[model samples]
Target: MTAAPGPSRIVRYAMAVAWSSFLSAGVLEALVFAVVDPHELRWFGAAPVELSAEALYTLSFLIFWGVVALGASLALALVNLPADEPKPQRGSPGWPR
Candidate 1:
C-alpha cells in the first residue's frame, strides 16, 4: 500500500500562521467588542464611520488577523533561518583575508 504524502513545508507554515492568526483575531474581537460598542467607533477619532456594527466587527477582525499573520510569518522566517553557517569574527580565519 502507498502512503499518503504530507503537506509541504511551506504549506505547513502557512497553515500554522493562519490558525494562530485566526485564534488571536477571535480573542481580540471578543475582548475589544466586550468593552466598546462598534457604533461608537470613528475614523481617526474625529470623523464618524459609515459602516454598520456588523461590518465594523468584520473589518476589525480581518485587520487583526492580517496583523497577527504578518507577525507570525516574520517569526517563522527568523526561526527557519539556516543554522549551519556561522558568522566570522573580524580577525577570524573564516573572515576574508
Candidate 2:
C-alpha cells in the first residue's frame, strides 16, 4: 500500500533553517545592531573599532545565521531520531523486560 505523504527531509530542513535565519539574522540581530551601531563600537583600551558598518553587519549576519541554522537542523534531526528498540505492547511477553 502507498504510504501517506509528508514533507521531504530537504523541505523540512529548509523550512527550519529559513525560519531560524529570519529570526536570528533578520529580527534579533537587527534589533541589536540598531542599538549598537558599528560606528559606536570600541576596542580594547577604548580604541575605536576599525570595521565599517557594512562589513560588521555582514559578518554578524553570517555568524548569527550559521549558528541558528546549525542549531535548528541539529534539533530537527534529534527530534526525529528513531526509537532504539521497538516498544512492547502492554500484554506482550517483552513488556516485562
Candidate 3:
C-alpha cells in the first residue's frame, strides 16, 4: 500500500535542532580560536612547521564548522525519513474496505 503523504513535524524539528547545534558550535569554535595559539593546533593533523596563529584559526574554524554542519545535516536528513507503511497482501489489489 502507498504511504500517506503529509508534512512531517518531526522532520522540521530535527532540522531546527541540527541547525541550532551547528550555529552554537560555530560560535564556540570562533571564540576558542580567537585566543588559542596557532602552534597548539598540531593536534588536528600534520601541517607545515610554521603556520601562523591567524592561519591556524582560519583552518580550525573551517574544519570544525564543516564537520559540525555536515554531521548535523546528515542526522537531520535521516530523521526526516518517511514513516514506514505496511504493504498490501498480494491478493488485495485495491485499498482495504
Candidate 4:
C-alpha cells in the first residue's frame, strides 16, 4: 500500500497560521462578549448596529480572525526571510572590513 504524502512546507505554514488565528479569534470573541453585549454595539458612535446578536458575534469573530491571521502571516514572513545576504568579495565595492 502506498502512504499518503504529507503537506508541503508552505501548506503547513498556512495551516498553522489559520489554526492559531482561529483559536485566538475564538478566545478574543469569548472575552469581548463576556463583558459586552452585541445588541448594545454602536456604529461609529452614532447609530446602533442593525445586526442580530448571532450575526454580530459571527462578524466580530471574522474580524478578529482576519486581524490575527494578518499578524501571524507577517511574523511567518519575517521568520522565513533569508538568514544571510550574499557577501561581496574582499576587493569589491560592498566588501566588509
Identify the leading candidate in terms of lDDT.
4
Lowest lDDT sum, 10 consecutive residues, model 2, at 81-90
Score candidate 3 by lDDT: 0.68
- lDDT at position 57, candidate 4: 92
Off by over 4 Å in 1: 81-97
Write out the backbone clash pairs for model 3: 1-88
> Each model's TM-score?
0.78, 0.59, 0.45, 0.77
Q: Put down candidate 1 lDDT per residue, 1-97, tens digits, no spaces.
A: 6568678668888999999999999999999999998878788899888999989999999999999999999999888555444544657685357
Report backbone clashes per prediction. 0, 0, 1, 0
**Could you give me the TM-score of model 3 versus the true structure?**
0.45
Over 4 Å off, model 3 = 1-22, 30-36, 41-48, 81-97
Off by over 4 Å in 4: 1-4, 81-97
Candidate 4 clashing pairs, residues 3+ apart or interchain:
none
Q: What C-alpha lDDT do the candidate models reach, one value each?
A: 0.88, 0.77, 0.68, 0.90
Query: In model 1, how many backbone clashes occur?
Result: 0
lDDT of 3 by residue, 17-72 (tens): 66776676779687886786556655447754477777766676777766776777
Lowest summed lDDT window (length 10), candidate 3: 40-49
- Candidate 2 regions with alpha-carbon error over 4 angstroms: 1-8, 44-46, 81-97
The residue-by-residue lDDT of candidate 4 on 1-97, one tens digit each, is: 6568677668888999999999999999999999998888898899999999999999999999999999999999888554444544556665354
Residue 36, model 1, lDDT: 93
